[model samples]
Target: MLLTRTNPVIKPRTLTSIHEQLRDHGVNLFHTQMHEREAFKAMFSFGGTLETLDRAQVNNIDKAILNARDFASEVVDILKAAQNAEGEGAHLAATSAPMTSSKVA
Candidate 1:
């Protein structure tokens, strides 16, 4: 999983190079929204989950929620694919119900 890391000030080119290297090694990389970190920081400061946060005060909140949903879907897909690869898809089915912002703190 990859979260935004701004501290230490690494160049974008370097970051992309590292990401490419990791992908070449068959590493699964999950990238959250660029401003998702800010949204989480707001959640901590305001003492509430994403659903409880005021949309008017947060920027790109809708995108953040969509990003979360996409990430969750990708994870479930990977799990199901792995299960099928191991011949356990019939015995152990991986499933996920739709999630609300309140459920994704």
Candidate 2:
């Protein structure tokens, strides 16, 4: 009997790495916009409530969040296109596979 052994080492992508990739793809606003959103979230968490914030502050926060979302969507599209170009379903296959080991006695 023959046993098949598969060992795959996958490195998780970091937010900074992803942001760099997005920048390489010409979507440079992702990091800045994400930081803006995070700042808004921190403010809201520390502050009493949204009602306590001024109208302009709220609007700016909303706009920052929306911009971040839009930038993220664009990054997704760029990554999908790159995966498709490399090979159809390549990304899916890489992510789904697990390392395996077999022992025989």
TM-score to true structure, per model: 0.61, 0.34
With a 3 Å backbone cut-off (N, CA, C), the pairs that clash in candidate 2 are none
Worst 10 residues of 1 by lDDT: 2-11
Per-candidate Cα lDDT values, in order, are 0.66, 0.52
Mark the regions of model 1 whose C-alpha exceeds 4 Å error after superposition. 1-11, 31-37, 88-105
Cα-based lDDT at residue 41, candidate 2: 64
**Where does model 2 exceed 4 Å of error?**
1-59, 88-105
Error of 1 at 100 (Å): 51
lDDT of 2 by residue, 1-105 (tens): 111111112323664486567668876342223333433564556674433555554555555555556666877887888878788577778888996779786
